[model samples]
Target: MTFRDVVALWLVKEKRATDVVLAACDLLVAGEGGEAVARLAALTRLEADIEVPILLPEVMRELDLPHHSRGTVEGREEGLRAMAVRVLSGELTPRELTKWTHRMFGHEDEGWRLSELDDAYDTQAVDSDEALDAEVMAEVRRITS
Candidate 1:
């Protein structure tokens, strides 16, 4: 079944008739594009948190939800850009930036991938005990831009 079908079923199962959910599902089914998908995804995350694990992977490929090792999925660029800003502002340290970037592109809990970020994390050890703030920030800027 499609994502909208799954969402519609879930809404019925939960006995929910929220206009936002229905509207989002309708828009998504009709191929309305990113905003609708984002709205529906946010609604699902908020209203049906328990179902997200199953619902996301099984039904919502269009969402391109992030897995630990997935390369260059949606939102990663924006997130990295934001992190770069944080790094520049000193709100987050280089180490923390590395951790976040590694988490985005490397093994976190159960997933790993062959990626530039993973290679950097391995060789530079930026996520731990490495004072490579400038380097990490530059990399973040490069990728994000």
Candidate 2:
């Protein structure tokens, strides 16, 4: 699908505040010439107050990609073009992109520390309610003390 078509689909399917944010991120990362720019412009007109983060680094890591140094404009353009191609070709879905982004940037509870917490919370780790309560009490004490 064309870039605009994908954005439209996303809007219709998701229809949340975050969907707009995701669409803008996709457009900026894709950098598919004027069309992507145009969509961003339209979105800006619709909601001039929204905040957009510079998520290039997160996007790059999610795509198992790299960033272009600021020394070369050409390199930056090339990286954006590669990102655009991946998004447009359906090689990367927005949800997958978002998840990868969260994991890469530590936005989600999937990092090493969070994973350790999950492991600790597993049934095998705590054999009874008393153990769980003790763990929680210890954490509470650590935080308050």
Candidate 3:
């Protein structure tokens, strides 16, 4: 009915989805952020090819939303490493590891992960035992001499 609505419909029909998002972003900054987001969401529902990191994120940033494409890779790896340590220490069971890995990494199956952690634990346990043996031997020699 209105000119703005007509242009928006045209942009969406033409598959210029990014332009539609830009228009939505302007509406949002004009204190209609909610309505703009709803309109943009409907238009971009099935279209994933639009990469308007600029306009869409402007609205999100203004609204204090997390707008990044992906989370930090280093942080995710560090969390997994800490979780592995807990598993090796027997503080976390295999079932718990599977559950947590599923939630965090979308990995529902963890056979290989459990095997790797078990192998690492065995290697570290052996190294610790060898160090303790050397220390006891040194103490014995010192006491005898």
Q: How close to the true structure is residue 69 of candidate 3, measured as C-alpha lDDT? A: 32
Cα lDDT for residue 30, candidate 3:
68
| Candidate 2 residue pairs that clash | 30-84
Which one wins by lDDT: 2 or 3? Answer: 3
Better of 1 and 3 by lDDT: 1
Evaluation by TM-score, superior candidate among 1 and 3: 1
TM-score of 1: 0.36
lDDT of each: 0.47, 0.38, 0.43
Candidate 2: C-alpha lDDT = 0.38
Every model: Cα RMSD to truth = 10.8, 15.5, 18.6
What is candidate 2's lDDT per residue for 41-138, written digit by digit as tens? 35453363342223333433443444443324434233223333444466654334333323332423223232233344454454464554354334
What ordering of candidates by TM-score runs from best to worst? 1, 3, 2
TM-score for every candidate vs. truth?
A: 0.36, 0.21, 0.26
Which consecutive 10 residues in model 1 have the weakest lDDT in total? 66-75
Decide which is better by TM-score, 1 or 2: 1
What is candidate 3's lDDT per residue for 1-145, written digit by digit as tens? 2213323233223224555555665666665657436556445634524544334555455545443332444334334444544445566554454445445555323233433333434466554644543443342233223
Best by lDDT: 1
